[model samples]
Target: MEAPPLERKLAAILAADVEGYSRLMNGDEEQTLATLTSHRTIVDALIENAHGQIFGTAGDSVLAEFPSIVHAFNSAVAIQQAMWRANQELPEDRRMNFRIGINVGDVLVKNGDIFGDGVNIAARLEGLADVGGICVSRGVRDHLRDRVDATFEDLGEHSIKNIARPLRVFRVIFDPEGDPAIDLAASPVESPETSSFVEQSLSQDRDSDDEGHRVELAFWESVQEGDDPAEYLLYLERFPNGQFVELANARLESGGTGEHDPGIELAFWETVREAGNSEMLEAYLAKYPQGQFSDLANIMLGELRGS
Candidate 1:
């Protein structure tokens, strides 16, 4: 028998699954089912509002498609923010956090269901995401460049299970107050209040920059102690002929700073920013108590922990 011709098209797939669904269900199936039902209603409504179609679903999971990658990205952010708000009303133990992943690629459609590496990648990406977090493939990330207002932390590349090539993955930094795409019909006119705010923000940036230039801070501040040879090494690695090079070299030659393996602070910062859970902040603080961005890290830790 000859099989029917396959129907395929480009698509943006969003795959989401409840984090720790098995544990939640095992603890109380009835309650979990009840809460999931209510959540599904909210989720489906939001997806539809964003022009996304629910193509498939399994227990504690959802599969949706959006024609536009930007909208998909927006919807994913909105869903996580919505879920966070919804979870707040429930007891902490019963709250359900969903991990969402999005990807854009060619897809095969049959009987209203979608199947392809695109869908598969989305699912795998979902697994890579933190509970209540979102992950997107490089395709989606590239599409998001200017279409949406969001921040993504590059988590580097990964070799997917059963996939021949490695994939670049990025984690969307969760924003409590999610930003949705503006309506196409909305006027491009900038209102007085918005214009004022924008102007003020720019003014502040200019002022901050002036202050920053006087100090030439951040990276230099970390190595200022000049007590760690690795720190000097790091500075040298970053700036071979910097003003501090002479000092760094002199310090090194003088049987310099203790070899305390001055950590790769940039990479660590990236990991902290890509944190899937609040615990990463704690780990970061413990390791880099006096490191750069500790203040920001503390603030972020508090936000994630208290949220």
Candidate 2:
């Protein structure tokens, strides 16, 4: 009665979505839909020609599985270039650009549909990419390194929902004229460091705390800012029983606020300048218990008590 179990295989998955689909539809629904339909037609054909299969598609997104990393990368480049050429004739406001993300991992295929952390990570990476740009997982990058004629920039590791480990990322830069220049393999990218505020706080803590604890705090701050939380999680795996392990776990649970958000930052500044109250500080501390700006939270709380 039940369907057969899906087959599992190692595949390079490419996820792509239109960057501003909603905006385009809102501006001109009829034309936008027409363009999307035409674009999909072209893309579907290209994918088939490149030895890839289109297993899924949503409103403005597509998911394809390729047997080879090189084929996946080549298909993606072809799709982007074709779309770019098509958009050239359209008005700037009428253009529909896409963002793509690729990952190579084992996935389950059922009824031609793919499912796994591999698919989820690929979609999330697509969200992180710029319009008309491509972001690929480290696995995909490494697989395609020898075959592609594109340069890749390390974007560091990132955490993705439903994935147990951080996925390192690289942005592919397509050069129409120049040959690909391979750089000697380097160490993985580290997390970004906190600004002066965190540094000053750590400096003060250093004078009073044990050297080991100071080092731990430094590492924690780096993880918070420098690298993607997903990547930082990978670090934790390596140092499973390390000091600050509990703290790291807590931050991961809380989803530390490190990524840029103008709205949240503005609200935080407003709370400090206007309320100057413990209620505000408590709220922030609760939301970001081990936040890189925890010292700032302490200072605000102190001011609230007139200390």
Candidate 3:
């Protein structure tokens, strides 16, 4: 007699992994492990809050299943945003970026783990995501369209590895222009501030054509002057329904100024040294061969290695 059929169900699968896990590990295995552990706390919390379950995870890869496509997509976005916040306090080279992929498909589940082409596709799509970016399968994109209140860029069809057929993919652009809180309809639960902002914008009168042109000119001038995100944000607050709302939001998401914080770099270097290991010192040297703390890091590394 044939064996009983395997358990299967339609689910939203999310796959994510560190972009440069090996390089990080090579730099400092202990610190990499510690950092990964801390990051997992963030990832796991977001997944749980989204009502998803983590079914499997390796050193750097995570696979989870969600009952709803919207929840899964939202979880991916939340994870990315949270990671970005966490990285803000970290040194540039030590920042950990995650690539996430989401798909809605039939999956085989057993023993608290999931498998099937659905998972395979998600894994493949994760490989395509940019550092700190998310990619989703066609099913996810189709369902998320207007429901998510964000822009989706169609990636067209592509043949991914180990897949029998070509698959259509799309990327969720995390371009929050003025207010990061302007998540639109993407979030299932809206905060009072966001609701108020939406209501105010909808109720406000459209600027006169001439006024709009002047505001547009001013927006462009601000951009030309290299004003920071806060400046663009001020423009958005002043002209909620302005012609340049989209551009302003994009600039805000790009963080206006491209300068790195030297204080953060110094703090990160100090933290690494406090670990008191040759590997940590090596990591510091690797990231900043000629940086402010490089001389001390090099001396410590040499002393620790007796070389």
Candidate 1 TM-score, true structure as reference: 0.58
Residue by residue across 1-307, what tens digits does model 2's lDDT show?
A: 9987889899889999998899999999977875676567556656765778888888999999988888788878877876675666567998888899998888998876899977888899898887888999988888778787788999998887777888788999995223112110111123446445666668877555555544544565567555466856865886676554554555565565533443343344334334344554565565556443344455446544753
> 2 or 3, which is superior by lDDT?
3
Error of 1 at 40 (Å): 0.8
lDDT of 1 at 274: 42
Off by over 4 Å in 2: 176-307
Q: Which scores higher on lDDT, 1 or 2? A: 1
Error of 1 at 16 (Å): 0.2
Off by over 4 Å in 3: 1-5, 176-307
RMSD of each: 21.2, 23.7, 19.2
Clashes of each: 0, 6, 3
- Give the TM-score ranking, best first: 1, 3, 2
